[model samples]
Target: MYQLKTKETENSVIEFIENVEQPKKREDAYRLLDIFSETTGYPAKMWGPSIIGFGSYHYKYATGHEGDAPLVGFSPRKAKISLYFATGDTAREALLEQLGKHTAGKGCVYINKVADINEDILKELIQQSVQFLKETYPAEE
Candidate 1:
């Protein structure tokens, strides 16, 4: 199993957010932090170098790949924010249609600005993603 190196907690995440230079980006990050915290009921934490994550789960695939990862997370990128959701089979086509203006890539949904999307729909997406992860991984602890 791949072990997580960084401590997953609020202080570390807050410090990282504080260091963000751009005011708009920082504010967006803070909003995302609040949304993820409220939706997942897990305090925000720094994952690796840039990702802000919530909760965690351990996974072991039949192919022998194993690791522990955050149940949900997002990274504030230069061009857009990348929201992570591990929904391999669960289709979110309906939700995406209602998600407003945005793009997607692999396991990430990208948004240029939160203002361009519906806040309520965003929260619903987070909640649905959390539910999917819980059912797929079924937390060991």
Candidate 2:
């Protein structure tokens, strides 16, 4: 059994952001917190030590691996801010194309600062990700 390291925790998202070494990154985190919250219509929660996540869905893979994950999240890292969104959403690729300046990984989009990208596109990405996850893994009552 593999345990996910990034499981949601009770840590303070505000404290985490306030502790960011860069004042600008700290400010960007606050901006992202608002964006993700308003876009997803869900309040933020801490995932692991760094991630500020909004909304969540449980997923079980074909291989029997399963876990709950945030619908969308972001981490203000040292080098660049990493944005977390749904990986399998086809719309994500298209949105990434429209997103201004950023680099992406398996499931994280890296941006130097909030000013480096378009907030509207980021909001669209967040909305699409939440919709995709809700459809893919509808929440249980």
Indicate which candidate wins on TM-score: 2
TM-score for each of the candidates: 0.87, 0.97
Name the lDDT value of residue 131 in candidate 1: 80
lDDT of 2 by residue, 23-136 (tens): 999999999999998888898999998899998899999999999899999999999999999998789999999999999999999999999898999999998998998999
lDDT of each: 0.80, 0.93
By TM-score, how accurate is candidate 1? 0.87
In order of listing, the candidates' clash counts read 0, 0
The residue-level lDDT of candidate 2 at 57 comes to 92
After superposing candidate 2, which stretches have Cα over 4 Å from the reference? none
- Looking at model 1, which ten-residue stretch has the lowest summed lDDT? 2-11
Model 1: colliding residue pairs: none
lDDT of residue 101 for candidate 2 = 97
Q: Please provide, for model 1 over 1-141, each residue's C-alpha lDDT reduced to its tens digit, 9 standing for 90 to 100.
A: 565574354458888888877788889889989888998899887778888988887778999877778888888888888888776745566777898889987778998877888878888878877787778889775
